[model samples]
Target: AVTRELALFKVACTVEQRAEILQIAEVFRSKTIDITEETITVEATGTSEKMDALEKMLANFDLREMVRTGKVVMARGTQIT
Candidate 1:
């Protein structure tokens, strides 16, 4: 099996395009966490490759802020084989 890691992102878009921004986020399986008059923050989780693609896509938008948490893995008391 191909091991996949979870990466989270906080994408903030210009207030004027809050709804439109969601369309882009949805392509990468992201959800909104916070919204304001000037910005909207969304969270996305996926593999490194997926995250990279999503980041590239977001480049097309006007981002007020952006933050990404690198890949993370969890062990359930057992090692992978």
Candidate 2:
């Protein structure tokens, strides 16, 4: 089976930190879904481990909120009876 998780991270950061935060998001292949003067919302989708790693990295910053969905899995190739 293949599994993937989706997460949205809301981080509070100053203008000086925006570039750094964006860089980190880019490394995680996360998309910037929203942005404001004080916060940024990033969307990430990957395996659980990948999501964990991204969370860990973002923890260094002001991780204000996070929303994650349960694992989504699908069988590989044709169905087996």
- Best candidate according to TM-score: 2
Which ranges of candidate 2 are over 4 A from the true structure? none
TM-score of 2: 0.94
lDDT of 2 by residue, 4-77 (tens): 99999999999999999999999999999999999999999999999999899889999999989979888888
**Model 2 collision count:** 0
- Model 1: lDDT of residue 21: 77
**Per-residue lDDT value at 66 in model 2:** 94
- Whole-model lDDT values for every prediction: 0.66, 0.94
Worst 10-residue stretch by lDDT in candidate 1? Answer: 1-10
